[model samples]
Target chain A: MRILVLNPNSNPEFSAQMDKAVEPLRFGGAVRIDCISLTGTPLGIETQRDIDAVLDPVCDAIAAKEAEYDAFVVACFADTGVASAREVTSKPVLGICEGGLSAALNAGERFGVISTSNEARNAELRLIRSHALMERCAGMEPVNIPVVEMMHSNELAERMVSAGRRLAAQGAEVVVLGCAGMTRHQALLQDELGIPVLDPVVSTAAMALGAIAGRG
Target chain B: MRILVLNPNSNPEFSAQMDKAVEPLRFGGAVRIDCISLTGTPLGIETQRDIDAVLDPVCDAIAAKEAEYDAFVVACFADTGVASAREVTSKPVLGICEGGLSAALNAGERFGVISTSNEARNAELRLIRSHALMERCAGMEPVNIPVVEMMHSNELAERMVSAGRRLAAQGAEVVVLGCAGMTRHQALLQDELGIPVLDPVVSTAAMALGAIAGRG
Candidate 1:
């Protein structure tokens, strides 16, 4: 089976990180995962306008690749264009935010999220509400980093640890990294926080594999 | 890593089925799964009294095997004593109901559950409410079959398909088998319903594997 991990933003760095995040799941060779970035879009999906601009392009990408891939994953915390993409294909289409939250639910009763910025946190809150998981969400804290700068930010890990600690203090048993750009820090943050820190890319890939496995 | 899937009920047949349900996941050899049944409990966990009676034994079993297992899975659909078991070990402990619901959330916006009886349905509803997922739950429909008889019933698949159809009509995008004894019917039901049908045992096993992988 083949799965497409599409980063809605134009940043190739974020797409590369997402590919690395899901590398471990590819060892069994049952599924092939391809992570790609949507060209000609915003470098970072930080604003509502950025999210809106990518919706049609994301849907077009899914429709164009529907015949080649068994499943599709929208590698954005805001889950940009996931609903519309679903209307274009009968195959499974997953969003990183939904995938991360689902993984958190399995790890704990209450989960917290570490987002890239205040705007991203608000978007994630709306997504959580849509999933009817507002109660199980302990809280969302932002590191105040921009998505484009996440791969280069020296204090990103420290800020993430700080946000994670605060969430844990609020009784969060699990923490979800709300941005795909933060994919590379999952193991480190999980080690420092002593709680499960989910990488949305990895969680969604696992879920997609489960979806494919169920078909047989 | 080693994982113990403890079926709180005393039925050996059910325990064997649970073992079979998770067999496909053993291919990678990264984790070992062992399914065991408590020796002196009731044949099947039905009423509230049965749920209550297995609490201590489940906790004791976890405590006794804590050093040997990397994680613990409470395989009963009621999740007989998961919270209490957590107090006995620092290892990750999962309940099939929570795992199944978490998987369902990944599969769709709204999910329906197929239960064994009215009592089991009520128990599952309580579990869903505890997880703050009542809003995402479309409904629970019971087939009225006792847990012990689920495997022997020739009409089990037909009843499950009927229940799934009703749930789909109610706008449920996914279906979850609320009983571990119903594990064998997952793929068949999914084919018949044309939607994802989750086996709680399989779902919980996948989560346990994820938890183990995250530790690295």
Candidate 2:
């Protein structure tokens, strides 16, 4: 399957990281993937309107490339434009929120989502319910750091690992790093937390591939 | 106030109904509501493993009491534990998946649902998705049917005013609703056929009440 993943932001660095995270599934030569950074959107995560702003154009891009791909994956953890994109595409549009929630919820009866800020709380809650999974939340603790801010913070990796550890202490059998910027460190957190650390971008890509290719 | 939504699948009549339908928020006094249902488990929506099957004992029969009544909701649309009640519980659990989803998602956007089965087809994918929503569905349809044979079918309700009609014609704003029962009306077909309904039982309850109670 040929898949198009829209990052919905202007950050090429973060988009590159998302690409690396899902590269494993492509190794079997069963799927082809593209990681596109939205050309005119904001650089960091903010509000749904910010999401909607980028989403409108992203939908345009998906439509433009409709013939080339078997499916599309919206790589943003918030899963912006997911429904709209799916509306326009004949192919399946998988969102990171759906993929991450489905994977994390199935792994454990309860899970904790570590947020980048208090502002993202609604998005987090929305993602949970949209998937019929508000019941699975153990709890969510905000780190009070934005995605870009996390990248540049001192002791960044340590702080993130601390959040993961705390959620595990809260009985979170799995920890979902809520930002796409956290994708590169999924393995690091999973090892330290001693549980699965789901990177939505990577998981959505893998899930889209799997859904389009069939269960086998 | 801390609230709990208990899903009772010991017998699915109510539990199965609560899985994805929408319920309305009635009597908005000083009440905290929690809504949930047992769908993904075995027992035909009952004995779910690796989930909250154990919470049943802890849930108690809070549904009958009037004083514990700052307010309570059963969380299950089936109202499985509604009979032979006890305690002074004044509130409601608000488990009507179809009712709540209809009231909640219907208010804001076009909502539709995808089902896990095909048996409920030719049923009302749009009607249920629209109960709370005047017209929330973008598209809806079913996928696969699970193994359980259903008994009380009338509680399922017939399709009245199709919220799906608008969703399909206008390109649904949101899409959801997937469960063992809704399996009969899986979403993929609706979307494939052009109907969008979001069937998020837990999230809809949380948001609708949170919006009303002004609490998370």
Candidate 3:
């Protein structure tokens, strides 16, 4: 199956990070994952305006590539343009936030989220509430890092470790990285925290492969 | 990662069927799945006595093979001996029921379970309640097929299709096969029902791979 993992930001670096994030999934070659950035959009999907600006472009990208892929993943923690993309394609459309949270449910009873910033944390909470999963959420903590600065900051992993510890202290059995930019830190944080840490990109890609395989 | 998929029952036929059920996962060859059965346990775990009977043996098997596998999967819908097995090793121990339910959450809002028998359906409901997932469950419909007869029956797929249709009619967006014995029918039922169908053996195996990969 071919899966298009669309990073709805204009930053090519973030798209490359997502591609590296799913490197482990490439070992089997049973599914192909192509991570690409949306052109003519914001560098990072941080603000509400950024999210609103990318909706049409995200849908248009999916519509344009609809015949080329079996499934699509909206690789943003905010889940930008997932519902609209689904309306335009018959194939499965997955949102990373939803994928990460759902995979956590299998790993543990209550899960925590490590958001990139306080604003992102609030958005994550709202998304959980929309899914009626508020009760299953242990808590959400932010590293106070902005999406644009995630790749360049060496302190990113340290901040994430601290946030993960707080969530672990709050009785979270699993920790979910709330932004696609945090994908590279999943293994390190998981090792330090001694619990399952979910990268939404990998989780959603796995789900997409399962969805494609289920199509039979 | 090497994953031991232990079928607690003594039925070799069931073990072979499970091996066939996970064939799609073999393509990548990144993770090795070995499906095996206990030698002296009951042919099928159907009653409370059967569940109780497998706990020690399952724990014993895990203890014996603790050094050999990176993860373990208890391939039974009833989740027989999972908690006990976890105590025997630090490696991930997964129950197929948990894996299937968690995957369903990623696939849709609410899910229906297709059970092998009425007794199994009751156990499934109790299991969902224990997980605090009763609210997310659309309902469970049984095909009234016994675990031992699941492989021999010609009507298995037809009955599953009927149950899946009932679930779809009741607003179930995804259907989970409540018994590991129903693994081979996942694709056909999903095609017939026009929704995602989760086979617990495959789902749990996927989770096991994720867990093993996360350890890096």
Best by lDDT: 1
Rank by lDDT, highest first. 1, 3, 2
Candidate 1 local lDDT, residue B183: 73
Scored by lDDT, model 3 comes in at 0.84
What DockQ does each prediction reach against the true complex? 0.47, 0.03, 0.42
Q: Evaluate all candidate structures by whole-model CA lDDT and list the values in order.
A: 0.85, 0.53, 0.84
> How many clashing residue pairs, candidate 3?
1
Q: Candidate 3, B146: how far from true, in Å?
A: 1.7
* Candidate 1 segments exceeding 4 Å error: A28-31, B28-31
Off by over 4 Å in 2: A214-216, B1-216
CAPRI category for model 1: acceptable
Query: Could you tell me how far off, in angstroms, the CA of residue B2 lies in candidate 2 after the best superposition?
Result: 44
Candidate 2 residue-wise lDDT at A66:
95
Q: Docking quality tier of candidate 2? A: incorrect
- Which stretch of 10 consecutive residues in model 1 chain B shows the poorest summed lDDT? B22-31
Give a tens-digit lDDT track for model 2, residues A49-155: 78778778878889999999877878777878777886687566777776665545423446788787778877878776765556667777777776666556666
TM-score of every candidate: 0.93, 0.53, 0.93
Q: In model 3, which runs have C-alpha deviations exceeding 4 angstroms? A: A28-30, B28-30
